[model samples]
Target: MRGGAELSRHTTTVIAGGGVSGLSLAAHLAVADHRHPVVVVDDGSHPLDDRTWASWSDRPGLLDAAASRWFERIRVHVNGRTTVIPLGRYRYRVVRGSDLRSVVRRYTDPLPHFTFHRGHVDRADQDGVVVDGDHVRARWVFDSVIGPEVPPPSEAQLGFRGWYVRSERAAFDAETPTFFDFRTSQDHGASFVYVLPFDAHHALVEHTSFTASGALEIPRVQQEALTEYLTEVVCTGGHEVEREEHAVLPLHAAQAQRRRGNVLTIGTRGGLLKASTGFGYQRIQRDSEAIAKSLRRNGHPFDLPEPSGRFRMFDAVLLDVVTRESAQLERAFGALFRYRTAEPALRFLDEATTPPQEWKLFAGMPAPVYLAAAGRRLSS
Candidate 1:
């Protein structure tokens, strides 16, 4: 809604795109002792509560109150074998989008320093953001809207379709979540099915694929694949799909860095999602905390720390293998879950391992495949 009579406004900070990243930043800023005037702008374009975010963490934080479920163990299926890996200190947690959004709103809505604007942003820079033909001026801009575009060369897409289903019989391992099951057809790419059971008869069965260069499939195609997966490997017939959810994540894409002047980026726009695996909740949390700390200490949000360099290199190597040579992935991942050395591998993925621990875990990996991938990465 724009009017011709000098449509101009101002705030201490302008946050564009009210998705997970934008809302999370606002929540943190609203809680600080010395609060700044913040305005959150959104287009109301995409449905917010359409996906579930899952991550593995050793300890709960501020976001744990919204958790839908958690598991202490994971079962990985590969090459007609099931390997049960225990999460000794870590717990695999699932949080629904609707619950997360509600949590953020509850904390930020009552704060007098925060305001939410419903408008699509037209442009954003170090100066401010433009929404619906009106320029919103700000001293600093924390933008989570403009992100790196997916490149054409082997642009990997992590596509998933999940269904919350109920079975007529008791037919699920409720205590454990199936992290990955490679029994499905891999014609599209390295495909698998993941099951997160709510109880003996209710579960969220998801069919996922990792491929290079392709848009997400239509709803019918995704449904057929999920149904086929359920009948064959997961459970028997006589199960009804209660609800469906789908999402697509780009892998090995470029990252956004803090820009010059008074602009900073956060969340997916700032490369919070891990390239090898589509996990970003914890990263976004850590980033938001850092931003809040920066704002509290220096009265600005641009002086935040970057992710570890070693972890970035490791991720790049794994992404190269996944995009260039995917046939060896099932074996590669299966080796990581072996009973003898699963703990260090999990720690490595969490980016919490020491150099010695990382090397020990790397020793257990498919050395030849990763070595080749590493060489290619270095040369490139």
Candidate 2:
């Protein structure tokens, strides 16, 4: 009923933006230490069904219950030819946003200190956050809403259009998902389609693009590509689009920003999205776990380690090629999965590879492109 100055409402932690990162952080605190008073403020944006997170994990971790599908191996396509990549330790997994929220509630809803508020975070500072008209002071404010203003001018926008569909006939392999199928048109950029099948009759078919010029693909244009892919390649029988999703994310190797003295960012705002791959679900979970551990171990979440410089360099170089050399993407991307074991490439992409592993992987790549990219990127 009053502003934060009037009532002086307070919590140990205030989370701004309850997307993947914020909720993941909340889940960590709720599960590990229930005594921490945490409030999550989320503006109701995308519906739960329209949201899904797909990533890979080599070992067990939190949100396992939230996962609806797991793939032991995945397929990749280059010019209509397919290669099934074997993931020795890693398993590709999908978590529906609704399921993740429900599972998190199983832990957080019972905790007296945990509060889920539906509101917009208007401002955040060293003292606390302003949501709507209320001010909630907190010792730590985790933000996912605001960050570097798409700066570095951003190299590209990774666009996605996904259709959650049900086919009249068997149309997919339930156990394996197509990680990347390049049979789709690449006119827009380095585009591909991936099919994550829940069963033989239902799947989430998505078209993804790396628009090198940072231009967004119109819905009608992307929709036509999806229609062609579905009609000619994916489906044998008519399918119903039960739901749909569209999104555009920036691609840039931007540094994390500290907005306020006590406020730290999470998710994209925190630079968790790898500029090269546009994948952050796994990184977000890891970051959330680290932040939670830091709070318990050091009484502050800022005790987290900085990201590796080598990984930043790798992302820069990869981002350059993905955007600057979009036409040659097949050779650059397909090489990782073709005629080689995928474990090393997977580890490299995850930034978990050792120097030796990196060298071995690099030895097979076109050195000139990478070297030139490194020179330009490292110099800049």
Candidate 3:
């Protein structure tokens, strides 16, 4: 990929890194019929992998259309207790990554205003983005490139490996999803098992851990734990693993909103990820819509609302507690669900809780531990 030939053309908006965020922005912009010409740049290095994104929402949009499974109840297991939390009006849904990409492409591929380019963006400045040594001047550049990740003061990474397995007989309750199972070992950070059952015979069993980001052995340990879970708890009669998935989640990391001239960051790079839980599918949707609205209404993409500081503070406090007080983690989470209920806790994590609601939710936390963590964060 060279610079000179491709530099001849320019676009009004250049969306760098055509992953979920970029694809989402382009899809929304095309759907709204934005007047500006948009170009999506990529290095064509995205691996063909199977992955699933799960989130909670009331109304379905592009994500719902591509979803393969939905659940009305989530179960949380901790301290030898099981809690089945109903999803009242909202639905817990899972969408395949392949399907999401296909759905987005279907909307943008035929649109004349959108163009997909195959190359790497060298640099983005206030003026434009440099691709293959050539410059493509644009009014605004939306960059989703995450250079290097470093966990915040909390220093916790949520690592997990999941297997899509099929059992020989009925072994799962398809209507309910295991949101968290803390029955696994918690020695290497806060460890848990998560399961999403598609049917009586098939399910995705995952082992997740919250530990230091530098812990290289976390993945292997989590995999071992997942196997133990299958043998002891899930299915003893035997099961065959069909597909495997793994991820290292940056839990509650601080993100700085940066702009290099006209380059505005989006996606994980722009602090779109929910710091505490490592969930960003819904955030991506909301952010893409905001960007599209800005472009359509204000003729610029940067005219957007600021993220909530209070929610960010809350995330920081939780991350602090998770990393600093791993032993008390189970008790802390148990109290949260026990006091706040699943829906309110989910809403709080989703950053939708108001002042009064926040107080009510906070009532369930272990008072001294969280208060100390909050004090440390505030003093810092």
Query: Best lDDT goes to which candidate?
Result: 2
**Predicted structure 1: lDDT:** 0.74
Identify the runs in model 2 with alpha carbons over 4 angstroms from their true place.
1-7, 148-153, 339-341
Name the 10 consecutive residues with the lowest summed lDDT in model 3. 146-155
lDDT of each: 0.74, 0.80, 0.77
Q: Mind giving the per-residue lDDT tens digits that candidate 2 earns over 201-314?
A: 988899888876547577876788888888888864788889997889887675666445888878887888887778999999999998999888888888777888898888
User: Which parts of model 1 are misplaced by more than 4 Å?
Assistant: 1-10, 148-155, 214-225, 258-260, 340-343
Ranking by TM-score: 2, 3, 1
> Per-candidate TM vs. native?
0.88, 0.92, 0.91
State each model's C-alpha RMSD to the native. 3.1, 2.4, 2.6
Model 3, range 1-380, lDDT digits (tens) per residue? 32435543648788988877888888889887887778888887764237677888867676467787888888899889888988766788888778887888899878777888887888777777888778888888888874323323434677778899898878888899898889888878877788999899999998877766566655667777888888888764888889988878666456555455678888777767787777788899888988888888887777777778888877777777877767666776676577424777777777888899888767767889888988987787
The 10-residue segment with the lowest total lDDT in model 1: 1-10
Candidate 1 residue-wise lDDT, 303-360, digit = tens: 6775677787777777667656666667667766765435656777878889986776
* Residue runs of model 3 more than 4 Å from their true location after superposition: 1-8, 146-155, 339-341
Candidate 1: residue pairs that collide: none
Better model by TM-score: candidate 1 vs candidate 3: 3
